[model samples]
Target: METRPRGRDGTGVTNTDAGPGLVEPVPGYRTRVVDEGARDGPAVVLLHGTPLDLRAWDPLVPALRATRRVVRFDARGHGVAEDVPVPDVGRLAADVVAVLDHLGVADAHVVGHSWGGEIAQRVAVEHPGRVARLSLVCTRASPFPPFGELAASLRGGTVDLEALLGRWFTPAERAEPAGAAATVRAWLRDADRERWAEALDMIATFDGLADLAAVAAPADVVVAELDAVATPAHMAEIARTLPDAACHVLPGARHLAPLQHADAIARVLLA
Candidate 1:
């Protein structure tokens, strides 16, 4: 296992050839994961969203490693993971479960951002026994209105990455377009658009509001005050449905709060 600094672009870029833990070959793809922490400590899993991989969690890993065994992984078709034939929320959840099983973790606290939040919800609902807690950040319970159309536009390869990212960040962050562009480029380089499209489609059809009531674990909803992608209203609704849940709105933050406000997020998760 090797660790290296990935610069300061919030991209978590690294070229470590060493794969995380054990790679399990699923029917259509293989999953790569990093499992590191004290064996007796509580287990925590970090899931990334579209256009990003496990490295997105780099900002939070160091802090989380102090108290819990931290596990981060690249979703199928992202990062070094193999691209599977079919990509959907259910499949994505299954991939997560597979990683957990591989690591011999029966239960864990799961943290997910953006599209990953949708996968986290599915995992808690479909594999209730495996999830002890959940942290949803900058994500929604269901797909945004007309997400299919939006995805189609994205797939057409005509969308402006800068403009899209601008909507996700605050004005101050947007002012540094070069940094934002670098981050976006890193994601695009590692991401598979077809897989991204499939994941987005799954989110479009997902409805976890009803399932949240059945979750038997605690949940935390972190919303960026200035998030334009996943609005505060969407997070509020998610918090309302959970049986035991709390909300924390990060002031002046944007969609990538976990990266921009990593220390605050660490405090909340560790608390």
Candidate 2:
């Protein structure tokens, strides 16, 4: 079945409905696929963080499409994708490769936010040939510190979305997330608890500090000054380790900068 996730307008506001462009890969898992931009332009894949689906990129897609073919999808176990086991980062990267192969993209600029950033890091190092440019947004070089507490809380099989959202957005955004909050809540409500927990576990234990320098692709490290998890300092450290990487921090933004400051993110990615 094909569906169209409500496409967002130019100002980065998210609409609370699914729009067109869903595809089921012949030999891959089912995930919501939103392909935009010129087919002949350079391919770029946008990966979202935990709990949030591909729609998180609705606001940024237009800007990205101006210069490249932007491909965004729901990672497995989130959004419309199947609730498969959350294997190691290598396997997760392979899944991304499968998506790219299905789309006939030989290589792409891989942009990942938060947990997805961790996956992108692994992909750049493990599957260098498939990644042309690596952009890590609001990401860190070590395990997410809050994972232990998050895992323990999820043991009861309930997600305190309010609390989770609190950490992701700034005070202004929390007060008025401009429809993003509603969209994320809907996504989490539809998500499987076990699969989400598994993804969290994978993020909690992920540490790519040692192999970061091995990433051959030119990299861009973006961070939000107000982000508690992937702090600016942490992102700077990551930039220092990568052989070809630069860091940019958005003032007053939080962990979910991609959604909060879509234009700024697009500027960095486009630059």
Clashes of each: 0, 8
Residue by residue across 139-199, what tens digits does model 1's lDDT show? 8886565667656867898656666666666456656645543565557544567776666
lDDT of 2 at 175: 77
Residue 35 in model 1: lDDT: 72
Task: Tell me how candidate 2 scores on lDDT.
Answer: 0.78
Largest lDDT belongs to which candidate? 2
C-alpha RMSD by candidate, in order: 4.2, 4.7
Among residues 3 or more apart in sequence or in different chains, the pairs in candidate 1 whose N, CA or C atoms overlap within 3 Å are none
TM-score of model 2 vs. true structure: 0.87
Q: Candidate 2, which segments miss by more than 4 Å at Cα? A: 1-28, 170-172, 175-178
Residue 201 accuracy (lDDT) in model 1: 73
